[model samples]
Target: MRLENQIAIVTGSGGAGGIGEAIARRFVSEGAKVVVCDIDEEKAQAVAGALGPNATPWACDVSRSDQVEAMVAGVVPMFGRLDILVNNVGFTVPGFLRDLGDEAWHHVLNGCLSSTFYGIRAALKPMREQKSGSIINISSAAGIGGAPGLGAYGAAKAGVVSLTQTAAVENFKSGVRVNCVLPNAATKSLTAWFDATESGRKTRAAIEAYSRCGSPEEIAAAVLFLASDDSAYVNGTVLPVDGGLSSRVACIDATIE
Candidate 1:
């Protein structure tokens, strides 16, 4: 019950077996009231309903800043106080950097990076006034380095990390801890990407470092740590729950002269 009596908002929390849903469940199990938000109204309601009365469903497009702001503004009125916000809304259409169309490029950036900005910005005001809150952002391992076809996704996710750090520094004195998590989980969307296309399957097979996909529960555990007071002294930290794939650099060959 680390989050007993607390109110938390977890975005993109509708998909079955998604990271967002896992996080929402973790929060509720710890005694926090969670708002399960997603682009799809039915999905949002389903997840929330299954979580029981402590969970409420919210439907909105986080890529739209107006919707995001409005949602955040309504939270305090509904729940009385906001304690945590998990920016987990993200999507991407994988393709090569040079071959990507403008629409896809912008789509990836807006959904992944801009959406993160909207959530953090909207949550900051209430958190600042209360002088206590936690904001956990979900980034990706692709952002840490180059990926075969995740150029747009990588770039957008990279921005998320930078934004989290900046927000953390600015809100340090205000008691609102901002942190980011890089997760490599075997969620529905991720698995679909690899299984839906031939190129995707090839890429998945070739990648040895991250061949082992972690469960969504593992990622939820990291988010819980960041959301709770256990990480009170921690801020502006980018934690990797990617099973060390990001740090797996190839062994350089050197000949002794």
Candidate 2:
């Protein structure tokens, strides 16, 4: 068991078919005790119940630093130690920059970027004391390369990549590793966009042309690899589990026309 006897926390894991839930299940299957943290109490409880003895539910609004800190503090006492943290709580309101509101920008940054910052800051205390821990942050291919309608989201996710690198360098001497995964999966957000907009359709087609779209489980595999000792030498890296979608140049030749 790669994570045997380890204790892990996965935020935003309450959604029925989301990546966070998948990661929690995968960790439990690998013999790790998981804390399913979500803003929705009922949903978090439901997922934790389904995972049986290996999981516990914690209601937390991760964007709130106080709540995040409390969650981390509580977990260490309950589990005796914290071995892993997956900052998976994030969402985006897709819109062009000109059409996006100030509130929308704040929402994206708070949910996607600020929440991750809070999680990492809270986890660092326990992790540094243990002198051995792994933190896996979820980023996006949109972050690596700009997306037309997802500018705010892409920007926030890009911040995640920067934070991951900085945190890795800061904690490496303490035996803690920080890395991030840029996943291109058919998530609820993507599916909703695809159903509502023509641009979404084009984006999906382009992604599929580059590489077949993936599932939450496939993304979970990459997270697990980083969370385990198998990736001891890996840190401060942005691993794109995007089925090669992020490896190509999507721009057209300006001189062709």
Candidate 3:
């Protein structure tokens, strides 16, 4: 197993088939102990429960610095090692900047971008002390270019990419690797949302790289690579598992009107 005896924390791992849960499952299957962290305690427990003993449920609102800090502090003492940290918590509200409300704006910024900051900040101490750790921040293709109705989300995700690179550079001397992933997961909710609206359907149809959307498992595979020794020499990389969405103009909207 690539991650044998490793300890990992995967935030936003509550949803049954979301990318976070898929990552947690992948980590555990590879012989790592994982903390299934999410804001929803019940959902966290549910996912953790299914993953068995190697997965522990952790109720954490990653957007809250206090909660994130506390969670990271508790990991090493409990697991005896902090090997991998996947900052996978993110959500978005769709609206043009002009029409975007304050609450929606802050929520998107805090949840998607600030949450990444909080996780990385808290996890850095332990990873630095250990002298060997991997931190993978989940970014998005939305951050790559113009996302018409997703202004706040795009900005926050863009921050994630910048933050990942800066963290990687800062931690190089400490033997810690920080990377980022732009994953376009074709999870149930996303598929349904796309199917429910003509614009969403058009957006899905615009994907040029593959005939189908990338699965959660596929995204997990990319993340597993960055988290394990396989990526020992790799650092500060922003890998896109978005089926080439970031490459060209897939500017179709998956926004709520």
Candidate 4:
């Protein structure tokens, strides 16, 4: 019950198996009322229905600032107040930089970076007013260390990290804590890319060599830590929930020069 009576909004939670859904479920289990938002109305409703009365479904295209602002504006009226926001809406289009077109690049950047910007911008007013809030942006190991074929994704996610730090610094004194989680979980998104490319195979092997592959639940646990009072002193930091993968270099050559 760490989040007892708190109200939270988790974006991009409508997919069949997404990290956002896991975070929403975890929040509910901790006694928080959650708004499960997604671009797909049906999927959002399904997740909310499964989470019972503690969760409500909202349809929103987070890449659009108007929709995001409206979503945040509606939260307090429905739930009484906003206490937590998990900006978890993002997807990757795996391809080398040369192979990716401008359309693809903008798509990834808008989805991963602009969406986060929209979420934080919209959530800040309410959070600042309350004088207490937590904003957890979902980042990726690729964002930190770079991935061979995930150029656009890595760049966009890296932007998320920078955005989180800036937001945290600007809002900490106002009582709104902003942080990020670089998750290295084996989700459908990662698995799809892994099954499709040689670079993906190598990346997965490297991750396995460093640590056990993580699950959505494990990532959800980390999100809980950031979202709850447990991480009260934490802000403007990038917490890698990647099973120690971020702690070491992924290079295979280990011989001493």
Q: lDDT of each model, Cα atoms only?
A: 0.91, 0.92, 0.91, 0.90
Candidate 2 positional error at 87, Å:
0.3
Off by over 4 Å in 2: 192-196, 252-257
Per-residue lDDT of 113-146 in model 1, one digit per residue for the tens? 9999999999999989999999999999888988
Q: How well is each residue in 131-243 modelled by candidate 4, as lDDT tens digits?
A: 99999999998888767778999999999999999999999689999999999864877767766898778777776766867778888999999999999999999999888
lDDT of 3 by residue, 111-180 (tens): 9999999999998898888798999999898878777898999999999999999999988789899999
lDDT of model 1, residue 243: 72
Off by over 4 Å in 4: 192-199, 252-257
Q: Whose lDDT is higher: candidate 2's or candidate 3's?
A: 2
TM-score of each: 0.93, 0.95, 0.95, 0.94
Higher-scoring candidate on TM-score, 1 or 3: 3
lDDT of 2 by residue, 88-141 (tens): 998899799999999999999999999999999999999999899999999998
Best by lDDT: 2
Backbone clash total for model 2 is: 0
Model 4 deviation from native, Cα RMSD in Å: 2.0
What's the residue-level lDDT of 162 in candidate 2? 98
lDDT of 2 at 201: 87
Task: Give the residue spans of candidate 1 off by over 4 A.
Answer: 192-199, 202-211, 251-257
